[model samples]
Target: MAKITYIEHNGTEHVVEVANGMTVMEGARDNSIPGIEADCGGACACSTCHVYVHPDWVDRLPGKDSMEEDMLDFAYEPDTQRSRLTCQLKVTDALDGLVVQLPEKQI
Candidate 1:
């Protein structure tokens, strides 16, 4: 299992144990992490699951695909370097202590 830590805009953190092969969005949704609406589920069709990858761990994640890139363009605060659709990040042992910072708002 991978341990995913979600830090809300106000700095509150929610830690969830995610099974390998599951997306971050799924983990957040399953754990009821308040900020990750994930309206489009894990389809990469919405920016509701937008999150900022902790700068130190960015390189550990995979590069975004075109679809995720397009969706991110509509994010509330698209960060060229750290912004990502959580739906696109799958949990893995390599991401055991993955920490994602939530945006102030999802709109």
Candidate 2:
């Protein structure tokens, strides 16, 4: 398992143990991390699972696809380089210490 940290807007942190194959959103949702709502359950249909990848980890995740990019346009707080739909970030051993900063709100 790898450790994934979910940081709240107020700077509070929640760390979760993520299995190799699960996505970052899954790790948060399963562990009851408060920031990621994951309203579409990883389906890429909802932008409620929006998160900001730590600046250092931005290059670590895969580039967004058309569908995910389109959905992000509807995200509550969107950013071109930092914001991401966590549901698409699959966990990996290389991401053992992945940290994500949450936006203030997710509509």
Candidate 3:
């Protein structure tokens, strides 16, 4: 399992242990972490799972694919560098202490 932290726009923090192979969005939903809507259920078809990966770990994550980049165009307050869809981030030992910041809204 990997321990991941989800910080809301209001500064609320939720730390949870996610099983390896599960998506970050699944971790949030399973643990009831607020701010991750995941409307498309990790299908990469929606942007409701948008988040800002802490700069410290950004370089450690895999680069986004073209589909995710296109979907991000619909994210709220999107940040090309930090913004990412939680559904695209798979939990792994390498990301044990990953921290992601939630946006104010997900429409």
The most accurate candidate by lDDT is: 3
Worst 10 residues of 2 by lDDT: 30-39
**Residue runs of model 3 more than 4 Å from their true location after superposition:** none
Leading candidate by TM-score? 3
Output the better candidate (2/3) by TM-score.
3
Per-residue alpha-carbon lDDT of model 2 for 1-107, expressed as tens digits? Answer: 89998999999999889999999999988898897898898999999899998999889888999999999999986999999998998888999999899999998
Q: What are the runs in model 2 whose C-alpha is more than 4 Å off?
A: none
Taking all chains together, the TM-score of candidate 3 against the true structure is: 0.98
TM-score of 2: 0.96
> In candidate 1, what residue range of length 10 has the lowest lDDT sum?
37-46
Please list the residue runs of candidate 1 whose C-alpha ends up more than 4 Å from where it truly belongs after superposition: none
Residue pairs in clash, model 3: none
Alpha carbon deviation, residue 94, candidate 3 (Å): 0.4
Candidate numbers sorted by TM-score from highest down = 3, 1, 2
lDDT-wise, the better of 2 and 3 is 3
